[model samples]
Target: MNTSIFSRFQTRSHGGITLRASAFAAILCAALHAHAAQDIYFNENTSVSSPNRYLNESSNWYTDAGRTQQFEGTLSSDYNGIINTESKISASCASELSLNSLTYNIAAAKDYNNYFASLADNASITLAEDFNVNITFTPETGWNIQTIRMFHNGRITVGGDFNLTFDKNGSGSNGFLEFVIRNDSASAALTNRFQVAGDFNYTAVESGSRLRFVTGIGQFFVGGAMDIGNILWTINNPSSSEGANISLGGLTGTSGMISLGTGMASTMTFTNSAQREAKTTIGYTGDETTLNVTMRASDAKNGYQILRISSGAYGATDANLGDVIIDTGRLDLGMHSGMKGNYLSIAGVDGVFSATASDSGNIGAATFENGEWYAGKIAIDIEGELAYDKIVFNGRFEKTGSDRDMGFEFAFDAYTMRELISAGRGEFILEDVITYETGSSMAGTVFEGNTSGIQWEAVFGDTSLSVSFTVPEPAAVAAVLGAISLAFAALRRGKRA
Candidate 1:
């Protein structure tokens, strides 16, 4: 599993972009990497490339250091390794070294680059257990992606799972390809896991040439479970920590753009609420930070709302931002407020958060977030049309926070319901999604069910509704539940015929 013949001289980069080639793509890198099949290189003109050289010695492994090309051990996936030398050796890189795709160049030797050996300057590596690398790319141009660059006082300790995978076909302009990690791990706090997880089946191509997944300082810790096709593209984490520890559980995705954050300090957390595939936007930034999301407004996904959170275009601020507890969700069509917070809770039991800022392209002022909400456990501000008792969300829910309540009930029926405003100053309604499609059917009320066996009224008029009643106590649809309207049936005319 160890072989030789990879000596091409270098300069490359990924995700953050930097792979300068044009001498005809560096003369098509030996015809797109044919560096003699089982190619391996890390001889950096020997001298041991520096310090303790002996990665299971094959003459200290070479492609050129006057050792006349070498390679006698370590590498699988039919071999093709290249680490244009940064020299430093640690024992058993997966049983004395392994690679199928490891190209972290320090000097271009024609980008068939490879290596995982990340230990910069104050270098350090202790692989006591696992260390697999089916992928990692920093050798660009001939884009067959692979990279592993963890600088600034680098250090690694993998007791298990450093598994890799990212083989995106980069196109013209040499169509970029990447799998980056500028991680600053000194064990960033212990036990390595960094698993990028399975199902990279690929197919989200729009390739104007810029495939991505960038990272830098979220410190490591992910053995698996990063679902949603494992965040395949466009994940830009612009470094910033001090108290920027990371943990994200139960995430669903269509996450087209996730920007992470800026100068973090307070804290960051997301334990639930994530179901995207319709205009996805999950952003974050500085200040007080307190994110907690649980879902149970019947977990909407098809009736409307998989996810919607916006600090607007990603600059977040109430002078820095924080606080988003949505017990269940909705919003995000337009009119965003860059999320300046002080409050936006809408939590549990009957918690149903929905905001439809005038539908039709939602031009403005809807998911308004500049913070002014102060409701807890009870907020029922029904302002028209929101059905999903299992599929019915014709859009329309606008909440601005702060109402005062302990109870509110309104079962809704749809087909264009009209008018209903039960403003909860103490915040009411935790168990009724929305009922008001907006006027006319003459305002409905004409049920002649079996008035004589042949009757049907409500072509679009009386569709069936129930903002029912109960806001602490206001009964009389027959004392609360006797009759809530919208009824039909009872046909028997066979005997007369």
Candidate 2:
């Protein structure tokens, strides 16, 4: 048998000191080559038809038994060559992966654990062609990882399911699974494109877990349904401070929906500047869609505003683009900090619109600032046998001119108006009322014989009426009574004569 290079080095070390020094130099040279041989290279320009078996022992690839494999050169595959039996493959280089009219297919039903465990730092993947590819990873039992980051700058088309699982107790602080599609193309049309036709399921099983789908200057087009279960999915912009704008491309079907939480006490928050476009729309697919914010509690404190849209142009336009239809959720207007403006401002020339607060829900003070107060309508409907304190409209309740014919309808069972009078104020103006119906229990009721210092000025009519309340001075009431008594005594004397 031929003596190995390492064996020959050990044999010569027992000779003189000069031979021992030469033997050490030979061992150092062998170690350097072994380290350089660990990198696997694939050049598409040379032998494009050969199947580059990932586990071939005779090739330039290095494997740690059947556990892990690492590749270093630019990989351009045109067939099913990068297959994994029971090992995880990590392909990385200083530059990105160049896919040229090739399909980098991964074998199905194979459990390749921690596929990107040894990815080169700061290395990204680029797709040169708009071909189809499938990369699947089904982990075995008891496998946990911190994060898996995939940065692609090309048009990728997935042909199968893109399933990802973030195991419990696997991630710590600054640990998150993120997929970033950066725009590196000079052409505006082919900048950043990702289309997936299969089901995209991402599951996170830990607290403080976050899954982010970020895009630079391109759009994410999903041809199939996307289900993100129990992860705080943040859509971030690559350039500005605003959230990334996404187009759903009509992926939400009758049974498919883009759900955020797992029907629990979870939150999906959007943060940006105070502009209308900064507001995030849950169901902006331009179809009859439903955005479900499932709350497990019934208390108002427990049930927070599922959709908190805080911006200047929420209802600014007449087209009503991005009109959201929430399934079983509560809307909070002017709820965010430093957002104390109009709630709904609709231009009156389009058509008449109505804003209603019904079914035991509270609309807070100064909630409405109509563009034309007399043009639109406001309704406060109450059902069942319940009484409320008051519905305060703290802002202006007036018309454009002297025509006070604005529609204000109040339909309730039983309630009391809490003495709408200012102390020491003697006069109040009565505006036009469209409809007012006091129940039969309190019909024709006039509050009199009460020294509560309250006076009523009521104008009753067949169609419309207005009521005002004020406090009168004590001296004025006594002088009016004295004049009435003197007149009565003079009339008695004339009758006797």
Candidate 3:
């Protein structure tokens, strides 16, 4: 019963004690006044006149527990002004960070390391109109992100370099970092672009990450080593209407691979307007790889050569060129200019050169107008009987080396020695004959005359003879006849005596 008037409140009955209404209203007004002091609101089209507006009002953004801060309410900037901030400015909206026409310029030479760690998946940052802003996203160590999409509508000409570094968290893959340049304006004549005057370096540490450059109408020229898993170009409108091109400028001094298309069936056309050769090497680290080339230019009369072994790596097992099995897999070289003379040449340094056809395939079929077939050693081993349409040796068809007693068998349809006897070009001298059999009869098979001391006979039915005679001239024949008549007269006179 010693409570004071300030501590207790008297009700209408005075038996029950309750807090006074005026005191409760006073406490609520104080709480509301405190919250109103912390809350910052800006009307539509509110402009920031000074460049250091963010640094001037740092207390409004420093309420977060960590170095990262998130703007809680809907904040939009529609004025054409510049915001220079070293700290991170995250304008949160329901769907997009719609900077209507605000140019948010980051401070030069400052590393924004892990400042943009709070960007969510559904949140997209869009820079519209002539809002030329340059921002660098340099991740700190152990920074693993999912994706960060930046869509610029107008022009973003970064005066200095915008360096981006993606550090690998662990063995997992890093997410994509995409920059989209789109012309979101209604006017078709307006062209939006994003240009970097200084060097833009994007360094990736891991192998499973990708960097994509998407554009509706723009051109990207990357200079240095864009070391990512892949540099993807997603040209939305890739036609001539709104053409987009990404020039790599001949990736000099960089040792990496660039994957052109996304999937398996994607076709990438490589065309060279010049007359020089566009040569490409398809190499693999694995054991087996196949290269399929379908040349559809039937109208091209210029011959192209596919040299198989320009150089050789000779091994013990792979000592000869024949060891390399050139599998012409479904090759159809249809009547091209390459099918002319000297179509194929197989040459090697050492060992015998041989060509083989499989049981299922034919080696080739060609017609030679006038060409000599020369072989150092010709060995033909037929599995079955052999037949030739015609065998004509225009030159001397004689074995020139030492004659051995190997014993050979040769069957001919019709043997002729007329040219040898008449033209006196070559002599057919049979050294030895084991057995001789002819299909003709033996009535006058043997020759009865000699011509130029070279006599040849068509002997039939196992007859052998060793006779030599010299062909008499016209004067020699008359002298021989007169001598024979004189001898006959002398014999008759002797008998009468």
Tens digits of per-residue lDDT, candidate 1, 1-497, equal 42322224344667766554444466677677764346555555333144434343455566543446666654443444454443222221212333344333332222432233433433434343334433322334344333444444444444444444333233245534455554534434222223322211222333343334544544433322233333433222324334333333333444333444345432323332343323334454433333223333233332123333333323433222244455433322221344323333454433444442322232223221322222333212333434222112132222333234212322232212222223433222223232223442212332112111111121113322333322223343234233333221112344345
What are the per-residue Cα lDDT tens digits for candidate 2 across 140-172? Answer: 223222222223343444444445544324325
Best model number under TM-score: 2
TM-score of 2: 0.31
By lDDT, is 1 or 2 better?
Answer: 1
Candidate 3 TM-score versus the reference: 0.25
TM-score of each: 0.27, 0.31, 0.25
Q: What TM-score, to 2 decimals, does candidate 1 have?
A: 0.27
Pairwise TM-score winner, candidates 1 and 3: 1
Candidate 2 residue spans exceeding 4 A from truth:
1-162, 168-174, 185-191, 195-200, 221-234, 238-244, 248-306, 309-337, 340-497
Worst 10 residues of 3 by lDDT: 316-325
State how far residue 32 of model 2 sits from its true place (Å). Answer: 55
Off by over 4 Å in 3: 1-153, 185-190, 221-230, 238-240, 245-497
